[model samples]
Target chain A: MKRAAAILGIGTDHVYEVDPDESGRVSAEKMEEKILYCQELGFSVFFVGITAGTTVYGAFDPIEDIAIICRKYKIWLHVDGAWGGSALLSPKTKHLLQGIDKADSFTWNPHKLMSIHLQCSAILIRHTNILMQANQMCAGYLFQPDKHYETSLDTGDKTIQCGRHIDILKLWLGWKARGHQGYAEHIETLLEKANFFYEIISKREPCFRMVIKPPFINVCFWYVPPSLQNIDQTSLEYNERLDKIAPRIKERMMTNGTMMVGYQRLDHHPNFFRAIISNPATTKDDIIAMIDEIHELGHDL
Target chain B: MKRAAAILGIGTDHVYEVDPDESGRVSAEKMEEKILYCQELGFSVFFVGITAGTTVYGAFDPIEDIAIICRKYKIWLHVDGAWGGSALLSPKTKHLLQGIDKADSFTWNPHKLMSIHLQCSAILIRHTNILMQANQMCAGYLFQPDKHYETSLDTGDKTIQCGRHIDILKLWLGWKARGHQGYAEHIETLLEKANFFYEIISKREPCFRMVIKPPFINVCFWYVPPSLQNIDQTSLEYNERLDKIAPRIKERMMTNGTMMVGYQRLDHHPNFFRAIISNPATTKDDIIAMIDEIHELGHDL
Candidate 1:
């Protein structure tokens, strides 16, 4: 999105980022405030990007309220559902993306949650004609007028590229094999496993600290060693020390080759492990093993 | 290249095109003239794109002289060797890309002449650091400071994309299976086959009017029917009628489902067939069969 803004010659000052709530979800009020702030600065609110599932905590923004603001401002609402879009298949979790139908455009990657290999992403737009209007080059040599079949089916002109990879076949076949119900069940099972992890970490108490109640599959947490158990959580020195634990534990995890989990610092927070449960194959054993491995590696720290 | 220029905010007037010579190759003099014209218009010559193998006639530009002009103007020389880069593997055809080492950057597609698969292309740059310098976002969450092993190997920062397809594995494995010698022989064989087609088409005289002596694998020709056998080649009406022949014949070919060949119109020229011989599996019989099929399908036209 930054790249697109840069390409369009939008300056850094014009690009505003609204901070998310403590739960890592962006409120509609914050979005409206940012829009009004831009309007006050004499900038038109052309595009409003809402993260359907954020990277760190897998938090879903309040799309319904955000949609109302976007409609009022006449802005093109784009949803980045790259990680969390698969949850929409589940009947129980479909409410997470309640106002998704109101979005002007949405980007989803089947490769992530669907496990259909890498580079299988799709950008769906409300108006199909807009794609051709924006991208059609009408290169006479390739896309000729006189062809055997319906020329509209020839997708070459609608794309920016001359040649594209056949990344759709695997996803098509996978979807056919799994069916809609199978996919929903798969997503539901993963979320349930994430909930299990959240419960287990909460019961562990001082040994582990749950960052937030994850709304989706990404569970953010930190491993607290016995040495740091007595330290005040609000202390600057404590967070500085806590920041060192994850990277050290990650280093040991790499060397030991037991399990791998991603760690990152998100806005004033210390480095914490972001455990993703998108893989349907992941069992309770794998989740338990990850925790035990992190404790075993960093308990002395 | 045009798309890149557009993204960089260069207008169509600033983008100049130097026509190829009678032999279908762009000369150094023409390039220098274009560069001088751009300078006179107060435009900086930042990039000089030299086509290694043109689409219509498979012509190779005089790169050695073009490189010298680029050096004098302090312009970055980029060679579009998408079609002809595989010729580098062949000892006999390597002379076609004589001054390739002098180019600042080059685009090569292993999917084309090398016949690996679709969408396997590479952008080769002389300077390694330039890519990272231009593209690095410094996204702390994704590219962390503390990681195991060499962080320099993480190519995500060097690319504009967050997630990229693993396109190198197939190319690597294919290259390993077929060593340098095998690839050289493969390219040599294809070129030899193209030469055989050129010779046959030349011998066939009035039936097949050869466009130009192809420098590479593309053999451009017109399959003249018996109806227009006696007409003047320079007549406007004759060329107009000739233009209709290819599309008509192409329609017949598709309906018959015998073989497929590409046809296109160049500057002031009628639509002529461009028989590409990139397929190593193509035998002399296939070439002979294609001509026979064209004759059989297009005789009435």
Candidate 2:
């Protein structure tokens, strides 16, 4: 969130972003009209955040209409849910985190879609000592408020980190070997392989197109290159030959070691292919061999 | 550093602090007389930092006389050197970080003295693209300015982190299985077991005392028990009975699971025992069995 409002010093002219609706979510009525136009320019609106998933359009923002305008301006809301919070272990996508139990803070990143390995994340909060009153240092050589056991159970002085690594033991051993019904059948099989690759690349037209069909597992697309497939799809030479075909089919899928994805230019979209169905062991023949290896390496890009 | 000046918002009333000297370093003439008295109250002194080691007085700070008053006030020096930058891999404690290569950032953790395991730290800096102009985020779906390799070698757009963890392969396999003269003989055998536990607790003063002789591996002391060794040391009932004998000998060395050391009350030095030798497998008979286990777990507090 602009690096947590630039580490809370909060500057970019007191940061007030808002805009996101054509399905890349967040427009809770333009975030209540930009918090009533930054409280009519007097400005005190402290917190809102809201993005339930959204890194390259795994979009989920409404959050019960931004928690009813952050509980009518008592502000603080937060959410984030890092990568759709593994759709809250999917009771069929947990109502896309409805109001996230009226979030006072959420964050959740069980390392994106609960695969868990790389730096699993958390945050959570809700209330209790407010993260020990916003991170208590208490550092008299490591939190010794005369420690004979319960020095408030030394959470290392409620951390801004003075040595922290056990990062929740592989997210508590991947939630104890995937319990909650094996993480809701691995988040309903990665949302059914992102709705089966957005229903076969929106029924394969002009060699694949759909950029907005992905509501969660970030499918985004754009293979297109039968030599720009009869150009002029709102051409500027058909988006400069579809922005040089996803970095030349991602440099031939990293020099043909196999398929890869992630391309870019987001809003007013140009370079596409995001494909982030967070690996619940991928197969449907690896999403049809990533669309037949991006149409056999961009079909003569 | 007051949490990087409260994450750069910089306000504990624009943080002043200077003091340290009674052997707990940092008084380059009271830090250039508090940066010429905060520039005669017009205060524009950006950075100074300096430490070199100092987490509980393993003090070093005179970094070549604070790098000549941060180059005569063109400020920005920084040094920290988390635990004496492992005394620069010990060429006899590399002149306690001399001018630390005229520092413009240093940090260095090597997991405190190069044992390098839990989150091995780094920082270093000295100029090049200033950590990509203080952290870049050219995030158009992850820095793809037409990426066919060399999208400015995308270091995830110079990191605030969008998925990070390859935490330097166990500090590069413990510096490739201890090269560099086997990490200077494991940092000169943990500075010779902290000068052999500060020469047997300063030759066992009236049952041990030496709190300030340590300049590096942080020995610090006090154990004085035998029912407070005929008191009257500098009475306030002898520093409140030597501050309740190092937290009752650190709560009987954590209920007798052998020894640990970190006690606190620094400035007026009350609860003493800091110890911190950063384990080079301790043994000088585990520093004389940690002074016969802190005089047998503090002989009658």
Candidate topping TM-score: 1
Rate residue A186 of model 1 by lDDT: 90
C-alpha lDDT (0 to 100) for residue B61 of candidate 2: 84
Go through the candidates in order and give the C-alpha RMSD of each one to the true structure: 1.7, 23.7
Clashing pairs in 1: none
lDDT of candidates 1 onward, in order: 0.87, 0.81
How many clashes would you count in candidate 2?
A: 0
**Residue A290 displacement in candidate 1 (angstroms):** 1.8
| Candidate 1 CAPRI level | medium
Among the numbered candidates, top lDDT falls to 1
Q: Candidate 2 docking: what grade?
A: acceptable
Q: What's each prediction's TM-score?
A: 0.97, 0.36
RMSD of 1: 1.7
